[model samples]
Target: MELEKKKIVEHNDLIMSSAKMDTVPLKFFELAVSEIDTFNPPKDNTIYLSKRDMFKFLNAKDNDNDKYHRFKQAISKMQKQAFFEIREEKGKGFVFRNIVPIPYVEWKSYSDEVKIRFDVEIMPYLTELKTNFTQFALTDIQGLNSKHSIIIYKWLNMNYNQFEYYKKNGNRDGQQLYNLCNPIIEVDELRWLTNTQKEYVGRFTNFEIYVIKKPIKEINKYTRFNVSYDKIREGRKITKIQFHISLKGEKTIENSSSKPKKVVTLADAQQSPYSQLLIGAFLLQISDVQDEKLMLSLAAKIYPKYDEFVEKYSLDILKKHLEYVKAHSTNIKDLVTYLDNALENYQKRLVGQEKDNKESKPKNRKKGVIQKEKIPDYISNPGKNKLTQKGIEDSKAADELLAKINGDLK
Candidate 1:
């Protein structure tokens, strides 16, 4: 299914603005923002949004289950919590703190429509932006699970959008291209970006891992940008960071001669077997940046032994494990790690199941077991070794279907 391309427009200053928001509320806020008509901004702060639309964007289908309650909690939190800090300044006379971006909401259990209001203070930032605004597809962040990743992505978007604007206005030069990287952001600024100045205080290592490294990994892996950074140090202590950014699968400072990779959309996933497993297993979803980079990252390592993988493993084995992963995903903190373990366990089960099936079979059949040489043809499909000798004698259409899948992989 094609997801609606929800474009969000925010003033560059608003993009620079940082706030303390949990991931769910932030997601809810953005989804609501997408509903507003930014060009002709609403006279009133109210926006009517659909619960079905937001749920569909996130692929929240259940095996008969529970995301709506969390959605309710997020809406509740959005109304109660105030932003701790906002970096955007009007005239630099004073700074404001404890601001609420979306201060009120009203909804009914019977209706799918949600009525939410943006704080009147934020109206100027959202409306009638002829200049100094950032626009991007909401899908760029649809899969991002981290609140920090969302904030950092906005930071990257601000500079990158500026770079694109300059290039479009016929200012493409080495110096002009330099606009892609924002100036060195201090550690405090990083915390401001994540709204975690109080929490990660004094624990630089933990902050660096959770607040910096991990979010960057998600941003680079999932978004259109490939971001890198260089740290400025105060003797032994890391003091500041300057980011380097480029389009994913595109030419970069390091590889200017390299060609970009073809970005595969969800529609394209239907064709490639590797993509099918990756998408089907919910390991990755492709909305931006082509290539198989994200698709093949964690799952690919175990997903394949390459072409030999196609012959050895089938989609059924992977799907079984993926379903298991989905069931317990809340408990699985690191999905890549958990998915790797799940795949490994499934492989062992398949091996053991085939062994037991082999032993449980009657060796001498009246119709006879397929000859050793014919084994390859009968079982030439994906999950190649799965067909037992006796089953091979009984199987015809199933054998052909499996053979077709194996052949398609070639």
Candidate 2:
């Protein structure tokens, strides 16, 4: 049996239609809302509220209120006019079907709004590609009272170009089609490609593509297939390597456990004076020692023989070392000690008047407490009513006027 649609009822001339259906729950809506920009009226699909959210909003003593009943009443009314259908699949959560009666509008037409979310496992691909999201206003919509199904479908179609671009560039970009024809694709693991990317690529028949990473130095390793000439392109290899460096973090490497680790010893490191300078520079960059004295102390620990090296080098080389240290790392413990002593001596030079001014900092006042007028008159006038004659008269007049106004208005 078809679920009945309700008719729009007249309530203060407002066309109100809504539905009550089991949803994915408030947790899903909370997660989605924080990430998605909500739809305004006329350009929006049916508003989805999780069953949990509805319960909270209604504030029923024990979830026994007729709040959901009111929603069903509205949807039924709207359905009678063929505006839309509030539907729930047997196992799937609630879905408000777009039933807006517009000519040239086919329900089976393609959707443009492809929303895909990923778990943390897919963060590498999502971050690398740098996806762009564009939103459009459904200006084609007529009225907020009218069904916005057509507007929503239009919205879906409008946003689909991005996935289409991903489709055309599938082969070169490592996008492939799945066996199932549905616009969604799931893989055990996908790097440099989103689940959404999989959806676009997985719509093919026999074509399959895979991602291959190569070092920048090894660009000519693979062969390319030419479509027009049916031969490889002259001097151009298919397996070209592209190097990508990330400031956020390293790119994901599959089979990480199998890779060999490279370790260097302190003696091996000390063999290269340049390497020592690099290490010192790196340490200075990483350290949180703000005091120059602390930095000099750290430098002393890092290079106990720095002073001895200075005696062996020429004046020019010594200057170069200082320059390299300054350029590479700012380990400035010695500088901080000098600055601190200088600041203390400077402060000692201040006059008594200056010290008094420095000590006498202004106090921030509380809003009402510091105001003279706001302090209650009870403290000053113990005998008086504290309420002035004007106040009593005003109160009496307001009471009398309110009674007269209520009588007249009614």
Candidate 3:
């Protein structure tokens, strides 16, 4: 019933879309999806599942026979009420698709297994990913007690995966890169993401408490993401929300993909503009790149952690930190060690650096309201902008980390 590390890979669009369901049905859907051979899906649009395992997954007890009846009720509701409400911007206007995912679920009382068919409308989103997708272990949400936890976890996973992909690929820089980790959203957009457009409409306090804080708290406790949100204000009124997301302990865990991690070589990064500027700037301060032997030696030292450096610091930030590093230290033996140490030290002071702008700004929703800084359009309306082939190839960057837990090559 509680599948062992069963991994689910979903397109980024579906992950970001709204799915409002109770914990039991969500688990049931995931379990069934975990069974699909996505590459070679069922020809007849059907899949068979273990009824006993499904019941066990539902935590139905041998003595508690009422759950079977309850299961029927849930299935009936699923047919009539449970559906994925997907809305995406289509050209100048937006398109909405309501998909009843599993309409055909059948089982005989004598049979140990259940047979079900996925709606053809929902197949492409679930299988055969084109560019963007997210892969995570079902066990990651196994302990989650709420639907919000499940939903937000996937959303965070999608963003974090993109963040890492950019960090590793060395294409993203400036505001474009930083917003991946800390995204700003309109209150309405946040409501859409959580499927709570109706719940806390005018009640700002209640909205902050129930919709924003509680889900984030649950996610922080159960998931790998340590996320916190703050209300942002324009003049006196709070209109937007900013979520600061980072890994709980160390760097975020890699996705549950079976492919080997794709390493971005110094050679590979030479073609990237972000890396070119970074390498050029750092070299101007520490060493000259003209010397081939020394450059090769230095590349060997830094290539291992070049991604880490790129991920954390934009060129502007890195340049400032480099100036500080040069003024304080002299005769550095290990360039990688010195730079990394400086990065950590520099990162620590970044919060304090913001204090320089202490004009005391605004949020009625949360206790800590931040002043309205410039908002990146990407965070406000994600998946709305189409990128060229060279623009932040996250799907290409994270090819290896997209493996399934069961070692299915997605």
Candidate 4:
């Protein structure tokens, strides 16, 4: 089936922006602790490692049934509890958190991929903030048990500037490192939440610096893409500011000059026909420069209108990819039409050969009758000689009668 190409247009008023936070979530931060009692008693507590003699470890030889049985009890225990939750705040967007038992062995494993799969399945509904927390907190899990504090500290330092570095590289590996450690089952690390941090007024345990992004105008700084729109309220006029932003994810913001920010729209950027032609070029730059998966995520944020922004580039790229596949095919057999023609030709050839064989073979006949194939001629002509002799006698008698009558008359 063929799908029609969709057209995408950018409005003059709309602008694009992206942003990311540097601080790790409190839940994850609490998880990173040295309390050994939270996990199963390890024979050697000095080094962080999974229990070597684990009753069941997934291996290549295990069948699906065996594997399912091994984890069945633990998985069942988790279903009863609400492992994840999403709640709303009045001004702020939302909150998502996971509350589950975390097995110690699972957390100690080095595989980041396994950790993330567990996280997504168990804690399915995190708000945008919680989502960011899951992504950022993955690396901190190791900090809990590692002996080298400096190395862990250094890693966090490097992580702080990851957004900017990722921007330049246009890759997701760095961002994914943290997300890789999110898990479905709560590990012993999470139990530390109850033990290590004492409750104050039953809320607000430890204070850590969380880097948040607010409007430049709020701080009285000049932002490049800020604009005002007029709204009428009770016959009075009110103006609101809109900003177009791209999150660099850098620890630092570069533009220091404080001017009253002006908002620049795609229409303002491309007022002329020449600039409109360049809009596609501009989109290409943004798509190429940004992380592809994050772009899809951001697309989800501004859906419907963003759908147009996404449909234009995404569909065309998909079409071009499919076209490449079609163009590169080397033979007719690669197509459906060719396969049909080949099958018809094969059937015709078989029928023609059978007809030719029948025409070339000799036919046998006996006793003025065509003999059936595979029967001996003697068997088919049984008593045929006796019948011939009787026919001759009859003919002689008739001839004599006719001759005698003719003589008498003369």
- Top candidate when judged by TM-score against the true structure: 1
In order, how many clashes per candidate? 1, 19, 5, 10
Off by over 4 Å in 4: 1-49, 52-84, 87-140, 145-162, 169-198, 201-410
- lDDT tens readout by residue for model 1, 114-222: 7888888777777868899898888888878888889888888888888888767865665546646443578877887788878877857888888878888999888
Question: What digit string (tens of lDDT, one per residue) describes model 2 on residues 1-410?
Answer: 10011111111101111211112121122222223322222122222324443333324345576755653443344334323222334565644343322111111115322132322221221122223332222221111111222221222222233334454666422222111111121122221121123333542221122222111111112111100101111122221121111111333122343231222232222333432332332322312232334444434343334434445433333333433334433445554344334324433433343455556644663321111122122112336647566545644654564444334323
RMSD versus native structure for model 4 = 34.8
> Any idea what lDDT model 1 has?
0.65
Spell out the clash pairs found in candidate 3. Answer: 1-57, 256-403, 257-402, 257-403, 258-403
Q: List the lowest-lDDT window of 10 residues for candidate 4.
A: 12-21
Candidate 4: the clashing residue pairs are 17-245, 18-247, 101-186, 102-186, 102-187, 118-183, 118-184, 119-183, 119-184, 226-263
Clashes of 3: 5
Candidate with top lDDT is 1
* Per-model lDDT: 0.65, 0.28, 0.64, 0.27
On TM-score, who's better, 1 or 3?
1
Which sections of candidate 2 miss by over 4 Å? 1-209, 212-273, 276-410
Span of 10 residues, lowest total lDDT, candidate 1: 368-377
After superposition, which runs of candidate 3 have C-alpha atoms over 4 Å from their true positions? 59-64, 251-410
Model 4 Cα lDDT, one tens digit per residue, 1-410: 00011111111110010001111222121222222222242223221312221111222143444543444343344434313232334466644334442322233334321221223222222211222221222222222222112112222223333444555675655324322211111212122222212322232222111111221222113211221112112111112211222222322222333222232232222232222121222221222212334333323332233234235335433222223333333543322243234334533553565565566654552222121122222112355633345435533553454344334323
RMSD per candidate (Å) reads 23.6, 32.6, 23.0, 34.8
Q: Arrange candidates by TM-score, highest first: which order? A: 1, 3, 4, 2
Cα distance off (Å), candidate 1, residue 166: 0.8
